[model samples]
Target: MAERERSVEAMLRQYRELIEAFVQEKISADDFETDYIRTFTNDKCQVPGSEFTVLEKLFFDVDDYVSDPELRDSPEDLSGEQLRERAAATYSKLFGLE
Candidate 1:
């Protein structure tokens, strides 16, 4: 694979791991979103090949999710739960573990 595809693949794995961490409650919502999710600066999260559309879509979704910043006082509220579900869904699709 080319360097770009490899980079995308690496990012896909990283995203799955991070989303899994968020879903498992091993990390806080703020840590997952503000710190990690917000860092997904990929414009076209995929190259010519490699199945990563879900992760790409998740990147766009993260933009909308964190646009207005639903980060509340606590990461266990409805917003946080919603974020968790979203991340979990992405991880599921990325690995076909749904």
Candidate 2:
């Protein structure tokens, strides 16, 4: 379990570095945030919590996805459209929706 925690922490560090580099390279905040959201959502790591908040805070975004009430409460509730809407809203709030 300790190893897993270390691995997750390392990944979060790498993500933060990548975002920092993008910002340094004069990339638009909107583009950076969008890419971050897409990469995070498709990650095989299966982390939990609000991806937007986790990424914004540069924290290891792992949680009990299977056991979390918010996540499992309505497995069939968040449809594709709803997911997209939620993603967009979260992303926007985190990065000021630029």
Candidate 3:
């Protein structure tokens, strides 16, 4: 149980770093999305020693975050900075980091 918790925490930390880089323009949204999907959704995706069920739930939550309409439709009207801010806020909230 403790090991599973640690794995989840470590995964979330990696995600936070990726998100912060995206917010800072160190990585593009497209690139972030690609990496995020590959990390959590690929067929062979695995977090060693993590409970499969727990990881699955976390991945689903992230998927919902990615598909959020506010973020999805923002490109229609929002400026680059605005989009980044929105993404940062959403990610922080989703990850319980806010």
TM-score of each: 0.60, 0.38, 0.46
Against the hidden true structure, what lDDT does model 3 obtain? 0.57
lDDT of every predicted structure (CA atoms): 0.63, 0.45, 0.57
Candidate 1 per-residue lDDT over residues 1-98, each given as its tens digit: 88886776765665666787888999887677665555565434544444456665655555445323445443433456677787787777667674
Report residue 1 deviation for candidate 1 (angstroms). 7.4
Tens digit of per-residue lDDT, candidate 2, span 12-92: 544554454453544444444456667666666544445435564422211111223455564443332333344344444
C-alpha RMSD (angstroms) for model 3: 6.8
Which is superior by TM-score, 2 or 3? 3
Model 3 pairs whose backbones collide:
none
Q: Score candidate 2 by lDDT.
A: 0.45
Better of 1 and 2 by TM-score: 1
At residue 26, candidate 1 shows an lDDT of: 96
